[model samples]
Target: MILIRARVEAVLEPGRRTEVRVPVLLIASDRRWLELLPSQRARLKGRFGTPRSADLLAAVVVVRGPPSVLGPPSPLQRAAETVRARLRRSVDRLPADQRGVLPGMVVGDTSRIDPDLAEVFRTAGLTHLLVVSGANLAIVIGAVLGLCRFAGLGRRRAPPVAVLAVLAFVVVARPEPSVLRATVMGLIGLLALFTGRRRQGLPALAAAVLLLVLIDPTLARSYGFALSVLATGGLLVLAPPWRERLRRRLPGPLADALAVAAAAQVAVAPVLVMLSGEVGVVSVAANLLAAPAVAPATLLGALGAVTALVSLTLARLVVWPAGLAVAWVVWIARTAARLPYATIPWKGGGLGAVALLAAAVVAVLILRSRRLRLVAVAAMAGVLIAVVGLRLLAPGWPPPGWALVACDVGQGDALALAAGPGRAVVVDTGPDPRLVEGCLERLAIRDVPLLVLTHPHADHVDGVAGVRSHRAVHAVLTTPRGPGREARFTSGLVVRQALTGQRWSVGDLTLSVLGPLSAGPRLAPGDDGTTVNDASVVLVARRPGFSALLAGDVEADAQRALAGSVPAVQVIKVPHHGSRSQDPAFLAAAHASVALISVGRDNDYGHPAPSTVDRLRSLGSRVHRTDQEGDVAVVRTTGGLSVVPRR
Candidate 1:
């Protein structure tokens, strides 16, 4: 059995549907982990949004009920929490996305950060901007000193003041492991500067690393630590030279961004691949896009955090510029993350890291060669020309003749059934409209003849706008709207109930509703809280050479009923995100050639449960889960069936 002992951090914090993703802190004996979830989180009850300024001693544990606090948090801790809380409330009236990003830009109160928003940052390689780290600290403290210098403060006076500012900001940020690491690194650089050892950048970095490792040996094994130290070292040793070279041709602002992005990317790309198994194609470009917003957002957010203690209204007034800055960053992340080939999958682990490091070093060396630089520039320009030419002319995506595409929309379902050129039948928009919109855009789908919602779960139907955004949605099909779920994709388009035996055609593909039989089993009167997932509308699709059993969220009881009406198929969208609510006999009956499960990565609830995947595999179906493989597609050719993954 897998066991997780977590400490409650905050409660009823903003959620995605109503707002943003709330966070709870998991306090293990060894370390703390932030738990981001929709499951288990809802089970806790209380007036639980504790002000960040309070002594945060209370907790609701899932494994063991409320553990005793060893003692109250220290006064400094209380003060920091208060500032963070005030900062949070000051921006509470803003759009949830903007609000979620504000505290994060300042002190990293990411409890309000939506998982969908976080995922966008991850894909765009902008995770650092959202997380509390050295970069944020450096920007805030540096700006403070720069302001003082501009006001004619002497150099000696500015350094000491900046040092104090760093310490104070670190406390306000709560000195989590990553924050602590950043503080230590910043101090080392500052110490070097003060001692007139600025040329010893590498030595300063080495000393910081040695001292940190001695203090917390576990950090030696930390991916964050490796990334942090390497990134700082890159900035100190590599960025300045690149800046000088690029300044020869590029504007100062462009040159600085290019140098900073390249240095960090080269230094951390290997570790990033080691941890995430992919290198973002848009990392440099995304960083450039978001660069203009970071400093303003950070400074204004910090100002708002401090001012909220005095006047909430003033704090609100102060944060609007910060919120706008955050909005720009969010927009950059979303747009860059969805670009075709956002990341490049690479070999993971130590060997891959070492190989990539060597390659990065070689590229740096080539950049130093004047003659080779011209050739490299020409080669890069040629690649860009080819890419843009193809994008404008032949467009290489949605790979011709593809039959089915299962979008990687986190813990939800969004799929497309090809109809004709630029047309498809879309099913089940995921939780975030933006995510599903990108999926459709990637497929080049411009018209949706029929859009089917499996059920009324927020994860299933919430992304209606994505379906309606780019296309003329002729009609919509779904079960009778669940409580409070009457809103749909198009007011003009009809939402027909998906009763059993309902049949339709989109291009050559035939769709038949196979489940939610009329007059079927629902709950007894007193069991009103039971979910209606078992009542989800199941569909079966078939064409000349391809067939699929698309079971929505039906559980064992209804799975048995649906099995009786099933058609033999080559693929199946496993029901209920492959929860263990499956009936083995039902899976055996369908015997689909491929079983597809759509789920979010690192979800709280163990989805596409291991046993469920084993059950499908045991029944002779090759299993594919979206959480692991990403945007799975089934293509049928003359030979047999094949599976293609986005990344």
Candidate 2:
């Protein structure tokens, strides 16, 4: 592979950047990628996509070598990198929670953070700390000002000291685009404090916006930059009344903390909802829990960074309390993230943002009402109780006697056969690993004793990563390898060739594999895939009374070949995503009451061909397309078999 070095830049498109990933340009190199970081250079080799979705490049290799820096960075950038490196080293001696979280709390470095723990922050809504918001800057500067006052420094002396502290913080936190954005907001807040006119901060906010945009015209287009400004405005305009109202009952310090967190969350809720397409239900409480630790962590962390310039030993000492504080914050994120109803999925886009904004307004209005406040409080208590009660009493998942679930994996097939609590027999993985993983998470499936891939097609087996991400599998079952058609997936899984008459029983339920009319279990090599569809692994699952036939993506000939044994199943996974090339006779022989077509929405192939659906329906089979419905599950109720869709 040829390698070329280039500067890295964000994806040149709006609304595509996310906290978890970024699409970027490797300038000077010919690749356009989605996982590249901003403000850096890299050497990588990748292939550009062809036809539809062209221009997108997927990297196969990212070459690692010393970067060719033409010149040294500014003093501020140098100072920031130096302090950040020292801070990381000092905290490295701490436990994972502290080591991973302290630098993030202080300088917005999360490269060494754990993935599960990162997800915990997102679920609990503590992501802002890791992003380096004005909160970090304020904490550091406030601590300096407090010390100045304690030393009996005159008011005139304090402003300069605070200003110097802010400048120093900006340096030690890096002058990257994100840090620069946050620094501007921090300076605006300082202006308010220095002038003793909190209201003037509004004007300062506007000025900062104009000034930053003039210097970095691209700031006008950055969602992260916009969010930082919005959060700062929230602190100035909304936090005071919140503090006043909360102080009526809560202690002064605690009320202030809650006020600041609530203000920022409420202010940015619309934008965040639009970007993430979901609301973190536990965000308020999670932030409140982490609030007490933020100031101490930031202040002490900054102290530790400064101390490192003198002695590493003293730096470690200063970081101890900060590490403990961060540990507390990390604990809050992890515990609360795992709580029930921590995040509620929402439809994303302009409409979703508007809806969330309306709800936030209603909440504020209700809280403002004296008499209605009591009613609202009681109503909220009842709602919380009801939600917990329902989750405990009647869990929404693994509904009683749910036989199977056909995950909506977009143009591929993945069927989950229930075995026991948190366990399932997965049949076929979709085209993408992430999508399949999401389906498993929704099903709350954590164990897969068997993962059966019907054939070697990408759509049928590529999603192995999804399964690997979610749970461990006992064995991966597939057909014997063919020379040309057996799609290869690179994984460490032990492969078992599944052919005719292989059966497994679990708790009175029996799962049997019975097809691939090959002479033996060994696949014939030099076999081109003209008849590969006919060679799909067919599954028959029954639980004493009910049975379903899961036919992989077999076309007409394979369908006809397998039809003889497929008895009249109550549910059938229609072949080839309900393509046009299906056997009418085979459809009739299956005698399925409910036929499921796992196809993508608005797919280019026009899957579930009109003839296919018509043919199935003509055979008296109720047809359901995953494109129209979401995850379609087959349930055996007292009223007989019914198909349920969950979005």
Candidate 3:
């Protein structure tokens, strides 16, 4: 039986806390068992303890449940907690530079790493530096082997010593599932070396993968697991052949470095492309610069970690070496990130990844031969270059015409109007910042002449981050203030009331705010109730022969209150994302030719109800749902109206 201990760190539910365990995992790597006892489960009803450092040392063991479960208190939980505490203490004693790299190098704990520093690493394409993986284990083993050889231990003894070192390192790092997997793979590789059976590396890797997947089928869904496995497999299968080929063509050191970088990149590229939809062109260059530093940083960081266990003074001295290595890595990242077009975005997922990988394999195979390899690689490279060039040079917006776009933002509202060249206006920001940013990029919108925030709901305001990215904001109009108005305003947006008689120009299109008719009394459903939806800013946009009405989430009451104040419109954004509480009279007054509804599929609220849709259809208005049609666009010309739905 594996014994574990941990302290409650965060209260996830009323009586359940997310705990960090000590001594990490004491069980077999593939062990499966229940974690909590019946008596302990019964006593979990009341608040157990405060989630503070002082209370963290009071650890508890979980005697029942699957070992793969994250954050729940268990035998493994105590071990994780203990490692975290020790690492924290180590970091606190180190210099700033070494402190930044310590946890990541030792245990893949990057939660304490600053976001700015993380971004720097990302830009440099050295993100693997923050993760504890086979690469890290390899570096450790390589260093150990080098040390043993220097001390006069022959090559045969090197493998055993390396394996022993890996086992000890795993204990210090805490035997999390990921750490265990890495250790197992490292040990297998070292054993292969000792036995002169290096060809068994692939089978060993496959076995480790199968074992881990069987123990926790859910790990199959983990991106980290996929990345780790692919990277290791790449090193085994591709690295050796690449190294030999490069060695024949170039100097020994350069060939070896290039081979390592190329093999890992080729293996992991498809997975990275599939997940991020972007390829880092500078990854090879970044790795070549950062790879040499990894061993020193890891060894010194580990030394600092051990030294911290005994004397703070000793740990501080060790930190200097680690910090210097980390600084070099940071420099590499910053330089790589700043290179023009370092990352190229592409459409991603299984098909795209497979296609790229197939092309890469064909190119590599062709290159292996003396005759046809060069031609094949050149042809493939040309095809990729042409495709990328065409996409970059393609004209994004409709040619010299006015258009209104209702961006598909899941269950929130965001609309854009392209009036003329390089000019547009944005209506309500959506619920997701990333989605909204993507929409802006697709539309090729750079400047906002005016930004209209209809109301203060999270759906309408969450994309404020995206909006703020624009260089300039000429004006921002919002609904009249009430209880939560101040809190809802986007950080830098200048908020104003949509009073009667306010006019704004967005390129060739002119806009006017029509109603609320009067400032209604602050809504109060009950003593405990706060309703922000009752107040919405309504506006009308008109250009030459086209017109549209943007009605924020104003319900039936607000609509009735405005009555005849609203004008007829060619297009109408259905209020509250087609919620059932829409006012029929408001729809009748608008007399819209097309009604746009923004909502999500299978949303709990059952939005765009049949009744509301039928009402718009009865009024002879073509109904379009963003959820169904994706991004919906309407182009208005003197001839008539044309609609575009994303394919």
Please tell me which predicted candidate would have the highest TM-score against the true structure.
Answer: 1
Better of 1 and 3 by TM-score: 1
Residue 127 lDDT in candidate 1: 90
Worst 10 residues of 2 by lDDT: 47-56
Report clash pairs, candidate 1.
15-20, 52-81, 52-82, 53-81, 53-82
lDDT at 25, model 3: 19
| Tens-digit lDDT track of model 3 for 1-647 | 23233333343575786654222112211134334321122122222321221122342232222343444455545554555556567667555645666678766767567544665576556888887777678778888998999999986888888888887677556555566677777777777788887547788888888878887664676676787788878888999988998899899998999988878888888988776566778999899988888888888777776676677677767867777887788778878887755776655668779878787777667767867866766887998899789768854444346478888777789998876666678898887676777777777777887888876666787776776676456677776644333244555666667776688876568988875455665533221111356576788988877789988888888788776788888999998888778889999899999999988643534577779999999999999888666688887667788676652
- In the range 555-624, model 1's lDDT, one tens digit per residue, is 8888877776776788999998888789877787777989999987655455767799888888889988
Tell me the tens digit of each residue's lDDT in model 2 across 247-279. Answer: 999999999988988888888888887766678
Q: Please identify model 3 stretches exceeding 4 Å from their true place.
A: 1-102, 112-124, 144-168, 171-178, 189-199, 365-647
Tell me the deviation in Å of residue 126 in model 3.
2.6
TM-score of 3: 0.56
Model 3 — which ten-residue stretch has the worst lDDT? 21-30
- Please tell me which predicted candidate would have the highest lDDT against the true structure: 1
RMSD of each: 9.2, 9.5, 11.6
Q: Against the true structure, what is each candidate's TM-score?
A: 0.64, 0.62, 0.56
lDDT of 1: 0.76
